[model samples]
Target: MMSGLRRGPLASRFSPSRQAAMKQSVKLIVGNWKMNGLSAALAQAESIREAVGAAGQGHRVVLCPPATLIDRMRTALAGSGVAVGGQDCHEKPVGAFTGSVSAEMLADAGATVVILGHSERRAAFGETDAGVAAKVEAAIAAGLEPIVCVGETLEQREAGDAIAVVSAQVEASLPTGLSERDFAVAYEPVWAIGTGLTPTLEQIAEVHAAIRAAMVKRLGESARTAPILYGGSVKPENAADILATPEVGGALVGGASLKAEDFMPIVKAAA
Candidate 1:
């Protein structure tokens, strides 16, 4: 005989049918801690772990702290089933470059992924696509997946050249042999990032589909399984709709990721 008790709403949410759909694959939710954090910020990771708990089993969670905190974040997430990454890395394996951390060093520090060509890196530091390409290749050489970011500015979008601009950046930033494995790409419009402006669902679909098409052209079958994440002002309220759009596999959350309360809902939305 079976017990007559019923399952709780939260427990019943991930039904066997739903679990099958989720499986080993999941929507990725990555937090770009970006130049922020000290040893104290490890608490944020703990809070995030608590908030996620077992409920986030259906989604992949990544936390990217500044280089200074990557090792610490890695340790904190050791048994939490979350992954830690770096905000940036150098193009060379090792060199005399001051204030630059090499991809090899990041890999040594337990960073499985690194973000390259972020808008801030481009606008503030003047990073060119060629330079981004070098960094991507270095990261790949060191066995770190590079989350290559590509998008256009508000002016470019207004001029209707957003697709052209991002396409060119993709071609220049991505290295050869992209079809070898499923890497990550994030599309974050410069003007939308942290600016509280989000592109419409139709707009997001158009850009993401275009990006996927470009990937297929460049990488063949491997492009089909690649995870393309959307960034720039992603919020819980809009996460579901945006993620449901074609080619949008997950998100690279910015301001919203700073708080567990704000970020968990987005994870649920993706799940």
Candidate 2:
């Protein structure tokens, strides 16, 4: 454990072995349940927890279930290797925003991490780069690590501007005042998500390298080592190769993450 770091309610709940694993600076695999999951799905969480615990590997694992499952999953995964998180959060801590959940609420619900600036949110809700930066600030303030996503569209790739588009998004969406300790970045191409399609290994390496260079320039030197994850149609067959690529720190698993049976192989690949 880092000296002078207080074990808050969230940290206090973690088992010693799990806490030790959290201290390591290495690859991380996070599951974004994305508006899916229910009370019964806790069983899946249990299975995932057991699988990770038994493997006894060093890679960090997180499950970002829907907002409703955050509290329960946190409690259920207590003293286990799996950490819990929220899929998204509003910039404000509190408000009358009827259906929106804030960074503070996610923390209060026991989330240690929160995903921000995903392409889906940007496209569906028209979330601006400025808004994502604010949400990043809010997430850090609430003691939740933020995984800010930056990606390009199919059209941009076809136009031969994939590198430029993602570079700009990384510069704009990721805020200043961050370090290796608190946040991560995901390169999830908007075109490939759930399309059963993915960028080539060479293509994935190119973007991740571009992202790393952009992060080093945008967020400073610490970002050179900051986790840069790959998302979009991540599955067992391609996971080993994807995780093996240069600058490909880890993955943000989508559909495969909903079930331990599917997600663990990816974990094995990372391990």
Candidate 3:
């Protein structure tokens, strides 16, 4: 572990093996295609799968296309070691909510993972922390691993409240069910998504460390081994440096993940 990036003071109390496990969790490279991809995109998924053969053993690579492509992508990438996921899911298993995809629906469609509480969902749809927590519960219940997202806006960072804002989201957006289920926390700064702007490595490290501390406070040791992913303008050019950061266990990639040529390098960087 890096000098001061150990999980927390409580980490010392755990067995050495447990301490090692915290830092040794598999690196997760997730491609968030977000409202992008059509049938033709299946070829890109196949290319990614072909290139990823045996390369992601110590890590995991997941591709989350739009709801329209979940099952098709899952079928195309079946047994390729690349998991398919959904960009979002509704909090309920079944309801009258028209046009909303439920966690159960995602699971039934062959999606093994789901992204919830993304900054776009929060900003464009006004999703709240409590709402995200509910969706997390739904995801767990539906047997899908949840990638719960939390981040601050550019204005919040400029006001010197980035850490506090993210900490609160960590406290409220994740549910107790995650203590036993496989889940991940993604920190995607609102301003960076699709803007080609990214936080400096030092800034990314600081926020990631703060996120690890927050998770420890909320879930104790169970949270230590959970992956904390950094999202926002992540690309092959900077993937290695960002993934090498102390508390950053993986990346939730956006635009750069839309194509095999661009996404493969980022996956290899994680590997």
- Quote model 2's TM-score: 0.90
Off by over 4 Å in 1: 1-25
User: Which pairs of residues clash in candidate 1, taking residues 3 or more apart in a chain or in different chains?
Assistant: none
lDDT of 2 by residue, 149-182 (tens): 9899999999999999999988888878675455
Higher-ranked by lDDT: 1 or 2: 2
Better of 1 and 3 by TM-score: 3
Give the distance in Å from residue 264's predicted Cα in candidate 3 to where it truly belongs.
0.5
TM-scores, one per candidate: 0.89, 0.90, 0.92
Give a tens-digit lDDT track for model 1, residues 54-156: 5645577888888988888888888776778888898888879999999999988878888899999999999999999899888888888778899999999
What is candidate 1's local distance difference test score? 0.80
Highest lDDT, which number? Answer: 3
| Candidate 3, poorest ten consecutive residues by summed lDDT | 1-10
Which rank order by TM-score, best down to worst? 3, 2, 1
Best by TM-score: 3
Cand. 3 TM to true fold: 0.92
